[model samples]
Target: FGTDTANQVEEALKSFKQANVQTLVLDLRDNGGGYLTAATDILDLFFSSDEVIYQMKEKNSAAKKYYASTDSKYEFVNGYILVNGNTASASELTAGALQSEKGYQLVGTTTYGKGSAQTQKTLSDGSVLKYTYAKWMIPNGTCINGKGLTPDIEVENVSLDGISTKDVKETLKVDCVNTRIKSMQKMLNILGYSADREDGYFSVATQDALKKFEADNDLTVDGEYSQNDKQMMIARMMIYINNHENDKQYEYLMKIIK
Candidate 1:
């Protein structure tokens, strides 16, 4: 804001550089509700202008690009975001900027999926009413409104005995997961879902495997895959490909199952 939010951020970053603070944690919880333009501007520091920081969608169609400024150069490294369940509005935007744009380590949980961007429209009654106008999507062309961005890793808020039993730590390497999803031929080869060899990337063999999984689970096996189905597919594959390396393959697998 004109009141000095941007400068404060700059100053903070400068201070971090001067202080040489390692393992920085940006706590953006319980503080949100902001102007859309401002959020996008701040996003510039962590992403290039060519990057589509986020998008605006009116209907359920593909999002329209709300691109970053091309003249801007933002690259943040070694970032850790501490987001909680109660965070909303502009706060969510900040967290999303870090997560979607920078791919920072998210250590709390999933975020609120309020996709529609809102504005305070002044009515004839001389009163301002909040009206939702457009939904928001990340630069990668993924919607983040009704469906919040899932964490690359899942961790809990509470822990004891220097260990956590109350929560599940499911670490998701973006590339590895996607590799596993896309390359279904390999999974099929090993699982005996088909006689197809693992060529990496989803082909007819992968789709067929997905259908079989859905049929077995009594879930609707639509050739068109998705997030829930993707998770299910990966879980089944995990049983077979336990802690398998080859990140590209993993990413392919994640995408197909998703």
Candidate 2:
């Protein structure tokens, strides 16, 4: 990661330490991934020193393993991780590492299962060379490329008439009453949006929260939550939970609701 992302994570961890959070749930659903170094650095925040976090092997090259160098400063007694089919690459790496190494509970569906490592190089002809040069494995020694790691507890997503909640554009707006609304509100609350209640009622507060999420994500500002907006909201919530699971308000909502 760059300075900006690292600085933001440090700020969040500082706030979490100040809050004295004990339990945390890191959500990795729909996270495609970024820099591998960034993922490993974040994993370092949870693991003890001398634990192997990742192993990499390139073509005809010896495998190299990376270990945690320091004990986790902000340790938690109970830690959970959430994942889904859209979680891939470095996201999958982090999830697998925590599950296999630290015994973190994984909840939700199977991950996207991308395990190869790629690198980009500028050639002498000014063209770029980008290709898969290696593959990575978690502490368990299993490479999650095509075969994804299953969750310890699989929680099905709420749906209506065989349609997922994120696809139901009409019934997901303000004042809607459905079982899936609770999931929507829970996600909103997890993302630091003011979804007042999780009683399956898309109330005014929920609508306002949806509006704020849309506005912040560069979507059309409206109370009506479209399918795209709902998906984006879920993605953003996953990112937020992955980064700020120890935030006081997020932990409070997680204990009170889902």
Cα lDDT computed for each candidate against the true fold: 0.57, 0.75
Look at candidate 2 and tell me the lDDT of residue 48: 73
Cα error, residue 68 of model 1, in Å, equals: 2.1
Least accurate stretch of 10 residues (summed lDDT) in model 2?
Answer: 157-166
| lDDT winner | 2
Count of clashing pairs, candidate 1:
37
TM-score of each: 0.53, 0.60
User: Which lDDT tens digits does candidate 1 get at residues 205-249?
Assistant: 566676786687666776434555545555666665454343333
Candidate 1 has a TM-score of 0.53
Which regions of candidate 1 fall more than 4 Å away from where they truly are? 1-3, 20-23, 60-62, 70-76, 158-258
